[model samples]
Target: MYAAVVRSYQESPKFEAIDLPEPSGAHDAVVDVLAAGLHPRVRSQADGSHYASRGELPLVPGIDGVGRLPDGRTVYFAAPDTAFGSMAERTVIDVRLSVPLPEGADPVQIAAAMNPAMSSWVALRRRIAFRPGQSVLVLGATGNSGQMAVRIAKLLGAGRVIGAGRDPERLRALRAIGADETVSLAGDPETAARRVGEAAAEVDVVLDYLWGKPAELAMVPLLKRRSDRSRALTWIQIGSVAGPEAAVPSAALRSANFRLLGSGQGSVTTAGYMAELPALVDAIADGRLSVNAVPVPLADVADVWGTPAGAGQRIVFVPTRGAGA
Candidate 1:
């Protein structure tokens, strides 16, 4: 079958005919992949950078996608960790890991929204003791996941949502989606951070995507215990798009009542993800969630592999050229 093969960690995926993955057990089944997203996790895995990456040679580089089974049931699935994944024309998936989609669900939309939306949905719903009507601040809000976080927070009943990002235009656009307000990470870093700090005083939860300089700057001011320390702040670390290894002030940790947690993978069990995934998929299928899906043929994987998906645009790969339509 035609698949996105990544033989070397340094190079982009090469679309070619490759042997299909064999199901290991009766519980597994083969899926005809309809659409798959070029997620950041897939990129990191292909380049051997993600913590969970196997560095396995001649691997198919996709983490999760939407596919159809023999019974014509459309489903959303994730590849088993450390295995060639969902980027092929057909791949074997553990049926237990696949969530059946609602009838008439858009494959490209689900394929594009699933991974990115799951990041925040699970984080907001399961990771911490999230209460309805809590205030949320989404850092790195320009990205697709971050944008989803803004809406997901509101959907889950956040009292207010503030989006913070480097792009002024994207940040403002977030307001129309779900954010009650937006903060720009543009111009002088310190000034932008101070502005974010001013807004952070009332924020009860922070879904942080960019963890490098922005996190440190956001943390320095946020972690300072104000006159009334009654509001319990939860900082959920979702992704490190900017850079890893943030230099947080020791004083801030010592002085604040904030709880910090890293979500995804090891932090949340597969059972937890599966338990919540159906609801998420249902929401997308019901059109409760909005995603801008840019469907490209899997044949073009080589061309668009490395380019970043712009704000609000998710790159979805359809294995067959006509399926993308």
Candidate 2:
């Protein structure tokens, strides 16, 4: 079988011939990899940069993908924490961790949207007690997952959704997709913070993807502008695209009713993720959640390894051409 093999942490995965995958677990089955997304998480895993990476080499670099079982059933499967990932012609999938897709489902779309959409979906559903009609502010809303966050917040019943990001064009585009308002995090820090504060001062929840200086800078201004500082504010940290560490001010906590927490692998249980997959898949399949997916042949993994997906675009690797169509 041919797979994108990553032999070094410093280099991109190379398309090469590899041994066929075999089922190792009792519930595992070897499935034909149809479509796999080249998500940021996959890049981190390939380079051994993700927190979960054990520095394993000579591995494939896909986290999740759409695959076909032996019985010709299509399913969305999350790759195990092993070297055998979904970026291959075939990979082992544990049936327990896989969700059978409905017939006629678009595999490329599911493969593209699932991982990124799951970030915001699980954060809103499992991470917090989010209520309908609550206001939400998505920091770093220009990126793929962040853009989905804006849409997901609205689908889940956010009365008002404000998207904040550095890209003015993307920020402007966000409003058409459900963002009630948009704020640019460009130019000077003070000016950006003031804009964020003005737009999102009374939001009930903040889906913060940018957690470095941007998050720190926006904190005080947002809190200060709130009509009632004591109002409950839940800040769910989904991604750290800006940076991992933020010098959260002592006053940011002491001054307002602010709650800070993270939502991801360790925070969300395996069962939690599995439970949400069916609904999320259905949403994407039924067009409740829309995504822009560019299908590229898996053989081109090395050539486009570091290229960023276009604005609001997700690149999906098609290992089996037309198999997932």
- Model 1 sits at a Cα RMSD from the real structure of 2.2
RMSD of 2: 2.2
TM-score of 2: 0.97
Model 2's lDDT to the true fold? 0.91
Model 2: how far residue 187 lies from native, Å? 0.3
* Model 1 per-residue lDDT at 281: 91
Evaluated against the true structure, the overall lDDT of model 1 is: 0.86
Best model number under TM-score: 2
TM-score of 1: 0.96
Can you list the residue pairs that collide in candidate 2? Answer: none
Q: lDDT: which candidate is best?
A: 2
Per residue, candidate 2 scores C-alpha lDDT tens digits across 82-170 of 88899998899888999999878999999999988999999999999999999999999999899999999999999999999999889
Worst 10 residues of 1 by lDDT: 222-231
